[model samples]
Target: MTRRISKTKQFIMMNPIIQFFKFIYLSLKVLVIVAGGHGGTR
Candidate 1:
């Protein structure tokens, strides 16, 4: 029972860490694309 609970906790922790990085990557990608588009005219 304790092992199962620990495994579940670890899985929960890992998912959020993975998601946070993914969100950061996506946001950076969007910012770069936006900057690239505006940079040429200015």
Candidate 2:
């Protein structure tokens, strides 16, 4: 778990754009859920 955390930290530091996209994706996911749409595949 610690290794995964460190790897993610390095990934965030190496490419901030990826982080931005990830954040946007998460936000959109939350918005979709809140909007009561097909946000999840379940």
Candidate 3:
């Protein structure tokens, strides 16, 4: 039970950083897709 609690605590601590990186990743992906679509249309 203690180990499970510690794991949950660790996950809670790390979740925000993970979400931040994920947000950046999604933004980059969207930018690339938009650029590709614009270039393709030309």
Candidate 4:
């Protein structure tokens, strides 16, 4: 039972780390798009 509770806690803790990395990845993609002059040269 204790192990199950700890596993749940670990799962909860990991969710935000995954979300944070997703946010960073999205922001970097946006930055790259903007830096390329909004597809003007494309």
The 10 consecutive residues of candidate 2 with the worst lDDT sum are: 1-10
Which sequence of candidate numbers ranks them by lDDT, best first? 2, 3, 1, 4
Q: List model 4 lDDT by residue over 1-42, tens digit each.
A: 246558676776679887798789989999998897744565
lDDT of 3 at 18: 83
The parts of candidate 2 lying over 4 Å away from their true place are 1-14, 37-42
Which stretches in model 3 have alpha-carbon errors above 4 Å?
A: 1-14, 39-42
Error of 4 at 1 (Å): 34
Q: Tell me how many residue pairs clash in candidate 3.
A: 0
Question: What RMSD does each model have against the real structure?
Answer: 9.3, 5.9, 6.9, 7.9
**TM-score of each predicted structure versus truth:** 0.49, 0.50, 0.50, 0.49
Off by over 4 Å in 1: 1-14, 38-42
Write one digit per residue (lDDT tens) for candidate 1, span 1-42: 246568676776679788798789989999999887753555
Top lDDT: which candidate number?
2
User: Relative to the true structure, how large is the alpha-carbon lDDT of every model?
Assistant: 0.78, 0.81, 0.79, 0.78
